[model samples]
Target: MIPAGRTPATVERAAEIFGKSFNYFQNQRLWEKLFPATIKAFHRAGAQRIVRLWDEEQLLALAAQRELPFDQQDIPVLPVADPQHPKPAEYQDEDLLDVVEAWEALHEAGSKITQRAWNTYVSRADDARETSAPAPDLEINGSRFWYRKTLLDWDKTRMGRGESPNAGRKKGSKDTTGPRIRPTAIARLAAAEGLLRALPNLPQAEMVKAIATTQNVTDRQALRILHEARANLGLPAPSPTEKK
Candidate 1:
């Protein structure tokens, strides 16, 4: 008998308790034959791997019948649900908002996002969808829509992080006057600095070009930042005619 509220176990764990290799279970297709109902596949959050879970009590029963050397205390319990996994919220047709409606909703929710800015974000989200990135909750008849809860949740998270609820500006936009740089650019800047240090012999011009290409900055701006970075590292500036 299956225990109530029993957590599922991974097939790998089940195979171990049954004193059988995973290949043995797969080759014989024992899961299909003996416990088809107990088999389930779950996709972990933000991962491509599919985890196969099984009913633990059923596996233990079969193991006991076969006299497999298994201890009930040693069985590993896999969590039934991932806390980070996104759950689809219950929503109705009235809760869905088209781009214009979503923009208005954002404004009403104190987002301070202009319609023009909102449209830019929508375009970016559409482009991102092509690469399997996050996008609107729904698209139909050439219109994109998001659930009210989804938009609100996104705004809440942004506000919680002390960032503006408005979506990020376009790449290379002339808006560097902000006090804080975007987190991703900061990370990439750090990486570029590390590369600079590791390859000190590399020409500053070449390094500047690389940083400009990666960070979407102009060569002049890249050169300025590179000079500051080198100075911080106690390295001398390369002359304009320096070929090394």
Candidate 2:
């Protein structure tokens, strides 16, 4: 019998599965066999309420797609009838796989979620997005922010480990790491504000000089970038009377 309650979030569902299957895998070391047994245990324990929660989550996801303002003709409109409660039908295959892989990796690593483990988690996430069917072209949603926060929390959890921060990344891959001056509009704005915070009422020439020295660029180039960044944030340009 299905439980009588609200649906849970994807992560919450994954956690439940982990709780149920953890011991089974620990004793038997059989991941493939543990899954079916866990589902059977869920029913035996009248924990099928979790399945309903999983169903609701799927419905909400589908409903979110339907609510998008943009045309979603290419999106799949799955039926919501007697939704498959959990397992391959109710939950996403990729999501389940992510939880499975992450749990096993972390478990093997003595439950220490290191940067390398995070890398594998993220690599699987990337694969999921690539292989999954196209979702609706909806407006920016909270899920993006939620996922970012989740990743950030996970990163923090793995802090202080001796793991390399750049694990699993190939050398010379300077996209997100390494030294580079690829400042975005947000970064530039932040720099301008930070400069003002550090040196209140700083002169334009001094600001330019500081940036130039830090960035190893000519004063003129730094001044140009500074002016543009200040303009972007609507901050007033530095006064000419300050030190050059």
Who wins the TM-score comparison?
1
Best by lDDT: 1
lDDT for residue 227 in candidate 2, whole number 0-100: 72
- lDDT (10s digit) by residue, model 2, range 1-244: 1222333334334334445454553455443442221122111133223221233343344334534543432232323222223332443222221223334323443555545554454446433432221221211212111122233334345433223432333445656564434334345446756786677676777788787776666887777778777776677765555534
lDDT of 1 by residue, 119-202 (tens): 766667444432221367655334455666676766555432233322355456587677555565555567567867789788
TM-score attained by model 1: 0.42
lDDT of 2: 0.41
Residue 219's C-alpha lDDT in candidate 2? Answer: 81
Model 1 misplaced regions, further than 4 Å: 1-95, 108-120, 123-134, 140-142, 164-189, 213-218
